[model samples]
Every structure is written in C-alpha cells, then in structure tokens.
Target: MEINHKIKDQITGFIAANSLVLIVMAITKYFLPPFGGGNVIIFSEFVILPFLMGIVSAWCWRKINISTRKQSAWTIYNTVIAIVLSFLVLKEGMICLVIVSPLLFAFILLGTYAGKAMFKRNNQTLNASVFVMLFGIFIADSLSVHRYENKVADTITVNAPPTEVWKYVVAYKRIEKKSDFWLFRMGMPSPVQSTAEGYYLGAKRKCIFSNGYVFDEKIVTYDENKDLTFDITNQPRDPEIMGHIDILRGQFLLKDNGNGTTRLTGNSWYRLYVFPVWYYDIWAESVTRNVHLRVMEHIKELAEAK
Candidate 1:
C-alpha cells in the first residue's frame, strides 16, 4: 500500500511540474510584449523556459521522494510535453523547435540539478545570487550584438544541357510532391512557382510561397546561359511568421560538366537581424538548405523530363 501511494504521488508531481512549465511558456509567448519576435525565442523560449523546467523537475523529484531509477523519467516527460505544447498550443515552427530541442533539454537537466542543489542547501541567499546571475546574462544577451548572414548553396548535376536547364531555372511549375523532404512536412515553405517578366537585366521575378509569401527579386546580372543573379527587393510581410527573416538575394549558376550535362549551383544570402545569431542560425541554416534543395531538385526533375 505504501509503495502504491508513493507511485501515485510521483505521478501527480510530474503532471503538476510540467503543467507549470507549459503555463509559464504560454505567458511568455502570448501575454508578453513583442509578440512573435526573436526576443521571445532568446530570453523566454530558450533561457527562462528551460530554467523553469529544470527547477520544476528538481522540486518535484525532491518532494515526491522518487527513486533514483525513476528520476530520469521525469526529465524526458517534461521535454516531450513541452515540445508538444509548443507545437500544438504555442504554434511554433516545428523545424526550429526540433533544432533547439537538444539545447532546451540540456537546460531542463541543468535547472533540475540546480533545483536539487537549492532545495538541499535551503539557502535564500544562494537562490537570490543565482537568480541575479541568470538575469544578468539574459539582460546581456538582449543587448548583445547578434547580426549575421547565413549562406547556403546546393548543387545538382542535371543530365540536360544549360539551355534546357535555364528554362527551368528562371521559372518552374509548383512542387507537387510536398512530402519529398522532412522540411516540407515541418512547415518549411515549398516552392510554388517562379515567374519572371522580360529576359533582360533589371527584370523582376517572384518566387511565391504556399502561404502567400512572395520573394520579389530584381535581376542585377543576367548571363544568358551561365548565371542568373537577382537581388531581393521585396519580402513577405507576414509579421507572425516571416517577419524575423529577410531574404537578401539568390543566384543560380549553370556550369557545363563537359559530358552533355550541366551542374546547377543554387546560392542564397540572407541576414538575420535577430539577437543570438548562433542559436537562430541552426534553424536558419537548416531551413535555407532545405528550401534550396527543394527548388534545385524540382528544377532537376523538370530539366531531366525534357
């Protein structure tokens, strides 16, 4: 009877601890200022969120008198629950969330251990000091300079010639198979259609997104059968989704493989003005690479079809 009662207590503590973590995240994301901004990701989502989860887990373990063997279960439970809540409830992008998942889990573990230490010592001064240190770091991170440009290039050798490839390069049809890559399933925008006006320099082309986001590019350098380079003039204006990123420019270079084939190299350069560029870069790099590959593969399919 005593064993069963202890198990029940442990389960209850787990639920309550994770619930508190979810609620805190909700408050930080929704009820806070700068809604849908990078600040939310940096200060609230990454740092404080994990810290709270850690603290809660530690508190629960100590309170419930859970066995050492069962203690690790609480950490895993907390992380999985938080991820689900972030996706379904918070409406965060799956790719970024998953990219940062390891970091968040680490934070939970650190916080849990910290929580254990705090409870063991039961010293208010120690608690106060640690809180101050974390707050200072968060403040510093907010004011820190974190602007960077991430460039991603993907190459595919197409069996068709440059002329055939160039036709598909400037513009192509919608990507019918949305499930070709994991990024597409994770909400990364798939290339719908690219349409260019005129064939000379200064021509404008627009690559449309499935969600109505359009990347407007102006041709700066146009080599008939070699390279097509364009500078981004207009970007998607969706504040809730596309506001954090600014796509700068994109280029497609066609190189002769000398074997009746062409090597298509796609390049994109974008600046992320958000703070803590390193953390966000993980998501940005993955997203850009996937986005590039999807388009390149789509072009390859169309070029090879002819």
Candidate 2:
C-alpha cells in the first residue's frame, strides 16, 4: 500500500471531518505565543477568519461520505508531495509559498470533493473541506514549526574605498530604482512608497506586493561604513490571522578584508515557533548572502559607471 496516498486521504478526511477542531486550532495558533514574547499585541493576535474555513470542511467530508480506503490512499500520496513542498517552503519562503500554497490547496480540495458517497453526496461537503484545510494551516503552523538556519559570507574587492561603498549603500535608491508591479500582478501601482529615510535608524518605508500584501520596514541600526540592519515591523496583510510577524530581522555587514578586497555579508532570520525547523536559518542565510552581494555588485557597477 502506498503510504503517501494514505497520508493525503487522512489530511483531506481530517480536514473534512474535523471542522470544529480546525476552528479551535486556528484560533489557538493565530493568538498563542511560544513562552517569552511581548504582548504589545493584545487579542492583538487573531485567528477567527482562518478557523471558519475548517468548520466548513468537516461538514464536507461527512456530507460526501468518502470511503475510508480511498481517503487513506489519497492522503498517503499527498503526504509525499507535502513533504517535498515543506522543504521547499523552508528553503525559499515566499517564493516557495507562492507555488506550494496553490498546489496543496488544489489537491486538498480534490481529495475532499472527488471522493463522495462515503459519507453523503453533498456539494456543500466539497466547500467545507476547502475551508477545513485553510483553517488547519493556522492550527498546524501554530502547533508545530520546522525551522533551519544557514550562514554564508561573500568577499568582494571593490576598487573603491570602504567609505565609497558605504556612500553607495546609503544611496541605494539611486543604485537601482525600485521596480513597479506589473499590470497583471496587481491592479495598483507598486506601493514602494514610504517615508522611511534611507540609511537612517528608525527610517520607515512601506512595500506593497502584487497580492495587495503590504508591510513596512524600519531601520534598527545604521552604523556608518560598517553595518546596516532593519526589520519589517508589521503583520502580513495577506494572512492577518496571526500576531505581528515583524519580529524577523535582516542585517548587512561590511568588513575590511584588510586588503584591497572587502567582505560584505548579509543575513536574514525569521521563524514561526510552532513550525519545527532545524536549519531554516542556515538556508536563508546562504540564499540572502549571495542576494545581497549581487546587489552590492550592482551598486559597484553604478558607482563605477559614474
């Protein structure tokens, strides 16, 4: 028997059958914290919109009357897909989320709706299952989190002096103008507009995504010619069920290689306590380190060209 298929069946069935659990779990995940954290966030942490989805799903599994065997087989197959997608999500964050979120949601719906007659053939059952899975993500993310960390360093010897690089870093807006959202992505202009002054501590700026998602960035440190760090100090507009996720951090360090070369390093750290992650930090660091260096190279090109 394919264990993979069975896992999918269970996820779908559980979601379709346990709507109440999903609702409760969603609320729990959205609001509860790991142990030590600030409550500048009152009931500030919300999860209701998420759980209602589950309430709808459980109703579907029962109404559809999906067979136990089929549910098991499908779930097993989906588990394999879920595992692969989980690793990708941990590694790539929003990039992976954009892709996996849709596929997983689609399959989950399929498992919930396609298997009818086990409980009772009802169209509402299909609708309910979709809500159940959406709600469960809230609970699942709250209950367990898989995290990992990665560290990376890059050495780039700019012909220019460290002070020169610092100036360019300070004037990043000049290096590359912020790109606008394509017409297809969002109906609105790229909301890269923010009052956050560049390279200054406490500077704040707003960034809008193609999905109408919005977050604001705030500078935490502005060490001249040495290090620059900032944090996105707001909650995700897309999934407003959870507490403020602005706890995440990002850093850029410029070190003199003691030679003509300079070492410019970058790091990013973000996590959901409930998610079990052993090395997401490492993975994120590796990816962002190069990403920053590349940005530095572009800066170098611009500065040199002038």
Candidate 3:
C-alpha cells in the first residue's frame, strides 16, 4: 500500500507542532494552576485552543499543496467541530457522551487516512495518533459543556421596590401568568397554580407543566430579595413522554439593579439530557425562556401599571 508521502509528512508535522505546544500548555497549567479565590481555572482551554488552530493551519497549507486537500479540509473542519461539540457534551458529562461520539466519528475517515498515511510501520506513531485523537475529542467536549454551563441567564425587572414585589414574586402559592409577548396564539393558558408542601426550604412543591406533566421540586434555597432556587425531582422515569422532556434545576434569582427596579432572573438550569445536544436544548430553552420572560414582563407591566 502506497501513501502520499508528502501529504503524510505534512499531517505528521502538523500533529508534532500542535502536540509540542499542547504539552507545554499542559505543563504550564500544572505549574500555574488556574486556581485562586474559589474559581477553578480551566487549564484545558489553554491547551486545546492551540491544537485546534494548528489543525486549521495545517488544513490551509494542505488545501494548496495536497491533491487530497479537499478531504483534509473536511477533516480539519470536523476536528474543529468536534472540539466545539466536545465542550458542550463535557459540560453535560454523563448523558452527553452518547452525543459527542457520533460527531467525532464524522472526521474518522479523513483522520484515519491522514494518520495511516503519516505512520507507515511505526507503532509509536499509531499510538500517538490514537492518543491525540482521543485527547482532542475529550478536550472539545469539555470546552463545549463549559461554554454552555453559564449560557442562559434570565433577568427580571420589577417596577416597584424590592420590598413591594418581593412578597408576591417570592410567594410560594402565587398564580403565575404569561406576559403579552408569550401569547403564541392566545387560546389555552399555562398551568399557573401548583400546591406547595411548605413555603420554605426542604419542602416539596408540586409544579404542573403545560400538558399535564408533573414535576416535584424541593426548595433548596429560599431567601428574601436575593434568590430562590429549587431542586426538581421529576416524577416517573418515562423518556417517551413529550410534555416534560427534561426536569432540570428550576431557579429564581432577585437582584437590585439600582434605582427602584428590582431585577428577577428565572432559569431552568440543565442537568441530565440525551443526544443531538443542540436541538433539544434550543427547543426547550426557547419555551422555558419564552414562557418565563413573558411571565416576568407581565410582572413588570403589572407593577408599573399600579
């Protein structure tokens, strides 16, 4: 079996160059340790970025010189995509691995061709290629998850002072409603009232979703004019159900935006989710935010109207 030696050399050289930088970054991360004052520094970010760039740069060079550059370009593109995808999956951790695998495979053909071309009989090259392949995939997924971890932030601005709106907004039994913007067509209404086990922490609250999907939430944290967050324990382990695709961390936060407006942020923090990582989240978040934003706007309008 004959391989295009020149193209093969380019791929190997690219890997060598990137790997050297990655090793240096890793060592630097180990010594410098991105840790101080409660924040865990993401050492991997510093490492994978250079490698991703190197792969892209190699693709550019190959695009001009190598006849199989088209394949190489796709390979590099997929590698970059893999990095982005890995970050997303890594954040989800448990369930997201199921998703990240297929994405990494998209580049498998090109990657293998390049790798095999580079290493004819060297066992070390084969091992190194495998190591880098796995490492790159993992780094990409980790970064994806990290990026998504803090993506959704919902804010609430109440017209009145905190003392006034805090009572109603933080109340356990208050009936919620949609703001005008959330009126998709305006016929049926969302289930606003749910029975509360208790108004404070460690107590359970029964929340009913739009289509009879039931969720049980424990009040994890409750504070006045600061934050109210709940730990949702979804009822029944049925994945086939469409109404409640995920029962994530449901939370409410209140902050002073200066002046008289009280900012309230409601969020449905993601926990466990399955593959096609982008689609479900995009769909679910749209509804969650659409509904919540409308509700918050109504609160604002109502508060201001008075």
The best candidate in terms of lDDT: 1
lDDT of each: 0.75, 0.46, 0.51
**Across residues 1-306, which tens digit of lDDT does each residue of candidate 2 receive?**
556655454466454433443344345436656422431211111223213322334334443334656554554444344435334532323443432344344444453444343235446666577557755664554444333333345556566556667766544542234433232232322332223456577887544433455556777889987887778687463332132222366566777767654566656565432222222233334334544555567656655555
User: Could you tell me how far off, in angstroms, the CA of residue 211 lies in candidate 2 after the best superposition?
Assistant: 7.0
Q: Backbone clash tally for model 1?
A: 1
> What lDDT is reached at residue 196 by model 2?
45
- Listed in order, each prediction's TM-score against the native is 0.77, 0.45, 0.43
> Which of 2 and 3 is the better model by TM-score?
2
Model number with the top TM-score: 1
Q: Which candidate do you rate higher for TM-score, 1 or 3?
A: 1
Q: How many backbone clashes can be found in candidate 3? A: 12
Score residue 42 of candidate 1 by CA lDDT.
53
> Where does candidate 2 stray beyond 4 Å?
1-73, 76-159, 174-220, 240-247, 279-294
Tens digits of per-residue lDDT for model 1 on 265-299?
99999877443566777777777887888888889
Ranking by TM-score: 1, 2, 3
